[model samples]
Target chain A: MAERKRRRALLRMGAGISKSARVADRLFLPVVAGAALLTMLLTVFHRQIQEIVSPSPQPSGEQQGPRADVVAYTVDKVPISDPDSPVWDNIPHSRISLADQSIIKPLKLNVPAEPVKVKAAHDGEWIGFLLEWPDSKADTQAIKVKEFRDACAVMITSYPSPPEARFMGTANNPATILHWKADWQIDIEEGFQDLEKAFPNVSVDMYPLLKESIRDGKPPKTVDIPEFARVRLPGTWAGNPVSQLSKASPVEKIVAKGPATITTLPTQDAAGWGRWRDGVWRVVLAKKMKASDGQAGEMVIERGQTYSVAFTVWFGDGGDRGSRKNPSMLHTLYVE
Target chain B: MPKVYNWQIGREMDYWYEESRPRRQAAAVFDTNKCIACQTCTVACKTTWTSGKGQEYMYWNNVETKPWGSYPMGWDVNILKMLGPQRWSLEGERYVYRGKTIFEAAAQSERVLGYLPSDLDYAYPNRGEDETNEIVVEEKFYLRMPHDLWFFYLPRICNHCTYPACLASCPRLSIYKRPEDGIVLVDQARCRGYRECVQACPYKKVFYNHVTRISEKCVLCYPAVEKGIWPRCMRTCIGKIRMFGYLNTPEKADPENPLDFLVHVKKVGLPLLPQLGLEPNIYYIPPIHVGNINFLRMLFGPGVDQAIQTYNKAIAGRDLELVAALLLNVSTDRIMTKFKVIGSSEVAGYDENGHEVVRIPLKEPAVVRPFYDERLQVYRHNIT
Candidate 1:
């Protein structure tokens, strides 16, 4: 009887163990599968996230005007006057100053002299001036050009010789002849005399291109220098009723003669000039001007005719005397 | 009998070798007159391929105005001045650099200085006028004179060439052009940034990033290209001036095609300066403007007129049938079948005659959307 009871107990124990094992297997498989599915879903979502964050590989066809972000390749925010600005401080201004000294000696002036005036006038209206180079022992002409350029903060590119005067006539035109002789000097008295001979009707008053600075009396306030000058002639010449051609007026027709090729000036708003011949235009850069003021040559074109236009600009030598560098002037033509 | 057999075998081998070489495909043609300087290509390249650090100053692809503009300042003048009046050699197959004639001083200085004064000029690559100034000139005053004119912008990038100069110049041999796809690539891992590649490239497109200290260039967007997408610059060009596609197999490509005229004829016409010995793949359509004829002749060479004539014939001759046929392959639906195979037609819609019509691709695609997930990543596509 005892043996039979033991056998029953053993059978019951084995049955319980088997039942527990079956339950564990049933629970474990689904849990593991659930975990794996969660991981896979996470991976897929991760990939999607990556794609979203990254820039798209495809191009979008839209005609949005140039974005500001796209435009200015580099701002480089150079400080005009602030000394602390990174770009300003790093600039070779001091080296430029040294170079200035070498250029100044040829003008035959002393270290400190009375201030001279360098006036840029147009039609008797004074546009700008530089007064910084007072009694300095710098070359008068050199100082005149240097002070004027520095005051205006513009570039003055110089070619090797007279034949390569690359930038001469106007500030807005392209370069043509690469050279010019720098033999002529700007003398106020001479300039005034020349003006008297050219324009007899208008009183020719002379002013120095540079003036004394009010704040320091020694340094000049480098402000408001025009890139170009406009001169207007008097209405009377040789007893004839000279037409007061408006410097700002549009002309009906422009004729190109001699070496001068008449081309329309590239203007933002002006109607295009008409093409009179192959590779030729009616408008040309002004050569002679009225003595009262220096102005850019006026351009004229027919109202209804299509014309080719050219832009003209002058680049000066950086105030070097012995280098014999001359300005370069050229024109770039375009159809409007 | 044995000698005859040998001759036949030799002829067969020669023919096989010729056939085995990879053939030129449909080249990218840029009509400079049509280019409006929109700079869509620049931004497209920046955002797509070079958005990372050190790429701020790098323009793997850039557009510079001619006559008065240059990338890295004075690249064109410097190189032209260096090469100094190129001429062909006796072999007639190559043009020699003629080192003795070129400007060694300028070239040597540039190699050492790595920068020039014009590089720092603020006036370079000037943008359009401000709105305030625009209104003032337009409404307030009519001075009877116009102002604020701008120079033309010329878009540029790597020309995955037939004989890549960058590939030959690299000491590490990291730069390579794939034989299968014709895509030029620089293996970044192998590149040490010695900058020999930078000097070697006549185009000066390759640039060194101070941050990365490695030379980088336009990759041609290989990933996107593989997926049938055009490069970012080609797709996003605002002026619709750029066209990208693969050249067809030699058997399929038409030899009579006018566009192939320049490539096939070796020396009697205009070709890339041969001294560099790098056979550049990209071709330029010269700008046509009535200016100093002498200057134009000097810059473009004597064959310019003939090249222009051939180009005009290709573009305007035979009722423009040659150009139309080469540009697009027509089917019943007027859908471009040939260009579509190379991904150009897909981006540019098709014309009635199956020529691929162009539209400026500038904006970023709208399909991308953000989602938060367990991986802390942003998801681009919709979740299933």
Candidate 2:
């Protein structure tokens, strides 16, 4: 009875996992569709499955120019992050957004609840993921007031059971999350614009701290001292501080651990990135196997090892951020 | 989720479902009427703590004109706009805010009806100082029609509220309010510079350090407070405006207790924007320049009328007996918990042990200084 009720509850919860999930904010959801889906998922995944398990869709490599129609289950196959890889032809492609009901009641999510087309690949040394989506606004700028950028993340958990401790993780178990931010990607690609660069025509009085100042009519005054040379003025400092703040240079650096542990990347760990654009965004995130003592479990895909994975997406425009984001349930995957 | 009753919202609000009852909660009182906009407290706070590179645009302690200035360039105006016009109707004796509480509005949202202002917004602290008041034109002839123009100096610091939005917004759960003293702080070791706290704080007190990539705020001089020393802003107040101490529980509240007397017993001090329902620990004696009833109520809640009347009585000696006793320790170096109205014009302050720490008269007599000093090398003391 307890298991039945839990499944029923999960079904009800996952029923309205989209914008239409609100069902006009008063109704719970269309129970019929949810019940049917839940029954099918439960039959296969069993009682322990908290996530909605949907069959993988073939990657619709059909974007601008479609050569032909091809469908393959990539989750069951060896997936790579490279978009050009032949494996991408067979993968899950759908419009997916927030599904969990935890944030739905309170947050009025206003983003494209489209299932982002996902393609995966692994080349022994590295595991890569390619996420492509169509957004009218690229929203790559996140450094301004009220400005939000589009972002996506992935979470991996090796432990099957751990008493449901969620403060990052209990003392014993740890989860590794890899977050990729659009703003960080942009900054990494082209350094954050400085005040002068953002506004070339504007000139103002120079404070004592600025290394290079263009005061009114005088030749640009240069501070000769080395110590003062490194001093960054308030508005003048640009570029993402991740590289400057952490030892990692370039923005969007990956830390293996959860939000609590944002320390340096784990040992022997490496990340590769590729972003394609054509009226939309296609981002590829690839990681290599490595060893680390970091509290955040390392992101290493050992051959024949099964791992549980989840996903999170941040649509900056919809003000989707922090704990106020849509996340997916755990799916088991084994790399070969 | 554990729920706490918020009097301002006139309802119970949900917390993060944790048993986080503090052993002792921190509290403070600020007399905005006495503030002179000297910026002494601002400088003292800056030199003591926020002198680092990334903290240049940050001011944990800032003072601005009531209606004109805000450190982050319209922090109040922006929040008000997001919240729109608030609606409230008195439910019997208590006033219940009809609009969404700051938390409720941002229940599952990323921010608490706030925006993280750009670097330019924080560049100037006094951009609109004294500019919100009516502009008066001087006539050629001396017209006898005298109009009263007023604006109060509003000094701001972290309230370290009972339910800090910053703590609730952090996904990493890095921000923690010390159970011993109730001081809200961000654990540098754990913070990822997510800036969620920066957005969630209604007052925008939490700052993101670009260099180290972490959140830092007014530590409330915890190192000094642990040693029983008052916060630097309170201790160095040239205008003698700020009060610092831990608030006693409702059961332990005594009229003689400084924090209780000003905040509860006398009801002279009120929290800034109680409509937000964070249960802010820091309370303010509303500035008299707040002639607009709605403005007054918006800042201090429906207690505006009562607070102003009570403050007027207390400051004007209508209730001099209790007033003098409460403010006696305004000049004392030692932080006191109790006060006694020993005489008509004099009062004494006592420490936690009931030991007298200071006794000051209603007025201190000033003496003329010597014009010349024997230790002077060349110039006289008075002839600079």
RMSD in order of candidates: 34.7, 12.2
lDDT by residue for model 2 (A1-336), tens: 999999999887787575575665545456666898899887766632533333232234353112211112224433333455566655544333334425322343454556566555555565666667666667665433345567776555563534232223334445555567675555445544333333344444443353332333232222232344333422122222342322222223244333345444534234434354664666665555443534445555676566555556666667665555666544444453
Residues B193-258, candidate 2: write the lDDT tens digits: 567788878898988764344577888989988777788877888998887877765456788878
Candidate 1 structure quality by residue, lDDT tens digits, B1-384:
001011101111111011222334323445454576667777878766654423445677777665465666666567667555654233353223332221122232121112222323212432331112223444534332112322344567787755455664554455777765677777664553445566567666776532233467888787876555567777666665554555442234433332243233311123233233333455455444423333334444344455455655665543233343333311111222232222322223343255555432222245543465656666545743
Could you tell me the lDDT of residue A161 within candidate 2?
A: 31
Off by over 4 Å in 1: A1-336, B1-26, B88-153, B247-253, B256-276, B290-302, B311-319, B322-384
Could you give candidate 1's per-residue lDDT for residues A1-336 as a string of tens digits?
A: 999999999999999999999999899999999999999999988975563343122221222113210000112331211222343222221001101111211121222121111111111111111111211122212111021111111111121112122212133432222111111112221221121122223221222221111122222122221212111111111111111111121111122221123222222121111111331112111111111211223332121222112111111223222211221111111111
The local distance difference test score of model 1 is: 0.35
Instruction: Give the top-scoring candidate (lDDT).
Output: 2
